[model samples]
Target: DLQQQALDSLVQHLADHHNAEALGVLCDVADAAAVERAMALTVERFGGIDVLVNNAGITHRSSFADTELAVFQRIMAVNYFGALHCTKAALPSLIARSGQIIVLSSLSGFAPLLYRSAYNSSKHALHGLFETLRYELKGSGVNVMLVCPGFTATDLRKNALVGDGSVAAQPPLAMGKVASPQDVAEAIYHGALKRRRLLVLSNVDWRARVLARFFPRLFERVLLPRLSGLKPQRAGRF
Candidate 1:
């Protein structure tokens, strides 16, 4: 976590409530060296990793034409390369333990959303990368699970960056009924327990995927207006 206090609170909560021995390592996933050190510490503390969850990500809200190139690079660095780094660092331990890799992706990974080109591309890249890894790792006893959750109530929107790399002035519109983080977590837990390859968390996202896949024009006609309405009111050019 970026904030050590949040990490410590979570660690303490896990210990107090779940009786789970947890270690909090303050490291930025975007930094390869930091991720390596974090992985080393985890392996040192726990002997080996059974599950590696690539959940670190950031989102941006801006039209592709107006977004600064640096914005896209920053998003990709954290959302895609961050996951890549952690996976690489933990692969040996995971392989040794026949462990699982859980990636917290989004419905946007497969389905398109307005003003999030960078975020969408990063998640798409994740699906491509990990799916291939899964195929290559077949019979290797390492499971890679990709989870696609719909609009969940989380700080992601509050922390979303704009084209100028500042915190967004407005929250991005939700396409469907907002999901609770608890519900999403429950689904992820069950999905991981079953070693499922793909876990789509919400019916809204499932329907959107189907619509986007089978009826692209209709999907656009229906979704575009809603998304367009949510576009930030500020000037597009940064």
Candidate 2:
């Protein structure tokens, strides 16, 4: 809630002062049909999509045992399938233009957090998909970058799904620990500009990721406690 208001205010200020003709906001869901329509509209308007930012996502805060099937699927639908749909729709234009694809993932993608099964799985799957796609699309002049942001304030928490495929009782606020929306946007721009394979936005996220790899048991022992405490109350109930 704090971050949303700030972000909205910033957008308004920029939109007013900059008179940014290149910037246009649209309401397009990440579903297959919506992406298809968006792509068609974009191509019709701008001639083609030079860059694709696959950032649409939702979150969940519950253990796998407590998470419902529908909740899990909904998370996948928005976080993973949404990206897929948009990427598929935009690929033809990107391929033609030799453009770039930027994916906004999360730290949870690299290292799992307790009580975040749906959210973690969606991001992990996204990482796998994009990493493989990058290799497969080599020499095609298409660049893919995955941007992993660590806990910048976002409304997804307020709207995050719970076990019953409904909004969580509380926002995902407590789970996130660092950064800001502007910080994340800057990271996104920098990574896209440099065409980096993976751009980690958080100050210590990369280090944490590496540490987790080198010391799994130790990482879990430390992280699980912190994560468990952040779990949403009454979240797992179907």
- Who wins the TM-score comparison? 1
* lDDT over C-alpha atoms for residue 57 of model 2: 85
Q: Tens-digit lDDT track for model 1 on 118-166?
A: 9999999999999999999999899999998877899998889999888
lDDT tens readout by residue for model 2, 97-123 = 999999988877788777788888999
- In candidate 2, where is summed lDDT lowest over 10 consecutive residues? 229-238
Summed backbone clashes in each candidate are 0, 1
Residue-level error in angstroms, candidate 2, position 12: 7.5
Clashing pairs in 1: none
Global Cα RMSD, each model: 4.9, 6.1
lDDT, residue 57, model 1: 89
TM-score of each: 0.93, 0.84
**Candidate 2 lDDT score at position 78:** 80
Error of 2 at 83 (Å): 0.3
**Candidate 2: where is the Cα deviation over 4 Å?**
1-15, 22-30, 173-177, 227-238
